[model samples]
Target: MLSVENLVVSVRRGPEIVRDVSFEIAPGEILGLVGESGSGKSMTSLALMGLLSPGIDITGGAVRLDGTDITHLQPHQRVARNCGKVAMIFQEPMTSLNPVLRIREQLEEAINVHDPRAGPERARELLDMVRIPDAGHQLNAYPHELSGGMRQRVMIAIALACRPQVLIADEPTTALDVTVQRQVLGLIRELCDSLHMGVLFITHDLGVVAQLADRVAVMYAGKLCERADVGPLFRAPLHPYTNGLLACLPDPESGNAAFETIPGAAPRPGAIPEGCPFSPRCNRAQETCRSGPVPEAHGPERQVAVCHFPVRQEAPA
Candidate 1:
């Protein structure tokens, strides 16, 4: 029930950092926002939350919750108006959580702010909801005392305190071990289904997207170059950047190199050219690709990159 229309974010004294990005997150749906570093994944999430840093601002477009536009709202105002309607689970829990406070103390803070039913029991319930064992005992532990996974779980519990309609999970599994990451991903999927929470999952991990997202939005150098369902996009990616990303995934069965990286890195904001930002690195790019606006290919539920040449119908799986 959340829609971001042509949302543009820019640094006040610099160029547009996040350009014309748009998407929707329906109830019970997880829309994965994927891109390499500097592709503006985190910036887009921050823009959605009205949490842009001092120099950056939403220069264009509208972010509406259900139907009302909240793009113009200040960070504090957005929190006040859409606290329960929209909530975010930040990328790093260690930085998000208070180091000095007890786990229960932190959780109770969230409950007291968004939920009136505050107490040790309510705090315990939150911990239980996130599948943290021995919830009561862990409540007394400090952030430093908990493992990385445990701390992330605590962050999720706090985000769920308001039962938010839209949950922005910005790489919740970033630093966890693989096993813990799997558990955390599964927990997020289960919570989505059980609570019918619309989630905007931001990560550069396509493997994680394949496992968690119903739909995908591929961003390149701040521009959304493709949009499609996970199945079609995975079975056959339509954009060069999407294909590049897919091809870079390690294939255990094929005995390929452990790491297959894309040739060039994503461009820093303002360093990108006027036309398609991906042209320099795109294999199919031509002289014409740099001369005009990026071409968009739109289908029922799909959109592809701007290219003067044809793209492969089926990406290497």
Candidate 2:
């Protein structure tokens, strides 16, 4: 399993950007981290990989892959162990992959980093594993020579070169079209099942979450507001922020004429409110929500919401 406990990230001697966030992804399971822009979802992922920018740092918390503690490791140290334990798929393949390098060269480089004994055959095998057709031909092509979807598949292939125990995908499908998005999502699920690798998928798309995630964790500003199984979280979201996010989804059955929107942009780090960072934009906010720290409330089946007045629902027997 990939476990993160009380993860805290902040700027150098500055305010926190990710506060006490914790979650886990079991082997063969996908945990979707959903939030609006600047909600610290990406920051949390960066902390796990020990890739935080110069001014930013992981102030507290633990990140474990399978059984190894990687929380305090330096960048080079993490990179050394990353191949067999943890790997990340970044947002844009164009930027993540080397534009000048042939697909084969890049894949070979990743494998050689951890296993020098591996050869050219391994690179071609990876392309096939990701279902990229004409693997042999594709391997010889440069990243720019392939389509956007193809480039993404190459990125996934590289990430899986060492068959990591845990995978962190940060908006991997954001740039793909609907058809390609579905294909990539299915590929991720298939790989997760086949490899039994825990996956932490970070994205703002709830539609994708509903389709891909086994569980969902809702984040706001810098804090995790709610977490629950995907079905329950979607059917009966506990946090108001989650409700607002779900409300924004278009419902073909309801025949709703307009889409709902969460008012106000998410607060930037260092500007978060003392109490609930979302209190300023929440429709149900009371004076208490804005004056004091919000306590986490527990519900059935391990559901958790950091709200004084989460949505009401009957407990399952």
Candidate 3:
């Protein structure tokens, strides 16, 4: 239900944070956006939600929600035009929630924003929807009173308050423990199926992507390096960055002690190289890789990699 094409977000009179990034999230599908820190994943989401902070703005391209161009629209405009159409679950629940307000007040406000006639009963139902225990009593509790997992569930409840068509969950499980993290991931999967909402699940964890996402998009230096079905992308990664990331994952079969790592760090924003940002660290990097603009190559089975020499070359069509 969401289509982002050639999206670009840049600092005012400065360098770009996200460049030429494009992806699509269809109804009832979860698209996992995986990347390292400062890779512009969050910035891209903020741009989508019209929540980009001052001094940063979407400078080019378009974001269409169900065929509507909401790219340059103000936050309020987006909400007015597509009420409850797009919602976000931020990285941290503790900060996202209000310190003073009770859970009931927060949820009720969200409900009323898109739906004025909705009452406190709606708030209670929302709590139950997120599978929170003692939904009736928890509404009276402040955010501090709830545990981390409970607070995250409440955050999910608030995001679902509007029954959004598109949900942008930016590292929603980052702060929770593994057990709680699994629960939250399962909940997201269940909700996506039941609600038939498209989810843009942005995270740095490939494990989570494997568990939850149907399709995976790998981002590096603000550009999409590879995208394919989750299984195929993991099974046979075409881009060097994708291959490196998989290599870094601990392999239980090998019983190896030392963790494999990509040799170098990612380039800082505004310091990106002219061509192929990952070329410097790529073992297969050649002189041609750094000489000019890198081009995207299409591999078999609907895979696309942004590199001159993909790990596996495209077959004859």
Candidate 4:
């Protein structure tokens, strides 16, 4: 299992930005981290990948892959010791990939980095694994030569070239249309089943989470608001934030009425409320909730929720 226990992050000499976050993903399972912009979704993935910005650092927490703690490994140590054990597919492939290099060179770089013997041939295998059409011809194509979805396939090919036990995909489908999005999601699902790689999928779309994640964690203001199996989370979201997110999705069954909107925006790390960061916007928040750490309710389904009074029903009437 991939475990993130009591993770905390802070800016250099600054206040905490990610607070006591924790979750786990077993091999072959996809754990979705869903939250709005600046909710620390990307930060959590960055921390796991040893790619946090120079000004930010993980202050407390332990990240483990199948029982081996790697939270404190320096970047070089991660490359030397955990090369194939962990890999990340970034949010934007166009920016992540080398624009000047052909797909073959890029994939070969990732493969031969850990195993020199596994060269261009292994690169071809990776492209085939991600089901890229015309793998042989595609390898010679540059990033600009491929479509957005095709570029993303190349990105996935690189991440899998190392055969990681854990894959952190940070909104890999954010730039694609619905059709291409489904193809990428399907490819990920197929890989998980075939390779048994645990995946941490980060996204803002609850609909995507429902379609792709076995379990989902809701984040807000750098705190874990709620987590549960996707079925239960959508059926009965415990936190007001989770309910609010679900409310915001346009329901075709409802004939496109104005999408429900949360009253206040998510708070920034430096501007969080004194106690519950979401208190300023939560309708069910009370005076006590406004001044204390929200009590967490833990249960059998692996559901963990921080709420004084959670919403058990849909946010809208």
User: Which portions of model 1 show Cα errors greater than 4 Å?
Assistant: 82-84, 117-120, 258-260, 299-310, 314-317
Which candidate number has the best lDDT?
3
TM-score, each model?
0.93, 0.95, 0.96, 0.95
Give the lowest summed-lDDT range of ten residues in model 2.
Answer: 75-84
Query: How does model 2 fare in lDDT?
Result: 0.88
How do the residues 1-317 of candidate 3 rate in per-residue lDDT, one tens digit apiece? 79999999999999999999999999999999999999999999999988999999999999998888889776568667763377899888778899999999999988887778886689988889899999999999999999999999999998898778899999999998999999999999999999999999999999999999999999999999999999889888999899999999999989998999999899998999878999999999898898788888886677899998889735437
Model 1, span 1-317: residue lDDT tens: 89999999999989898899889999999999998888898999888877788999999999988788888676458557653357788777778889999988888877877777565588898899999999989999999998889999999998898678889999889888999999999999999999999999999899999999999999888888889899988877778778888999889899876786677777888789767787888888778778677677654456554455536573346
After superposing candidate 3 on the true structure, give the runs of residues whose Cα lies further than 4 Å from its correct spot: 313-317
Candidate 4's TM-score = 0.95
> Which residues of candidate 4, in runs, are more than 4 Å off?
82-84, 298-300, 313-317
lDDT at position 200, candidate 3: 96
Name the better of 1 and 4 by lDDT.
4
lDDT of 4: 0.86
Q: What residue runs in model 2 are displaced by over 4 Å at the alpha carbon? A: 79-84, 314-317
lDDT of 4 by residue, 291-315 (tens): 8567887644777788888876534
Please identify which of the two predictions, 2 or 3, would achieve the higher TM-score against the true structure.
3
lDDT of each: 0.84, 0.88, 0.91, 0.86
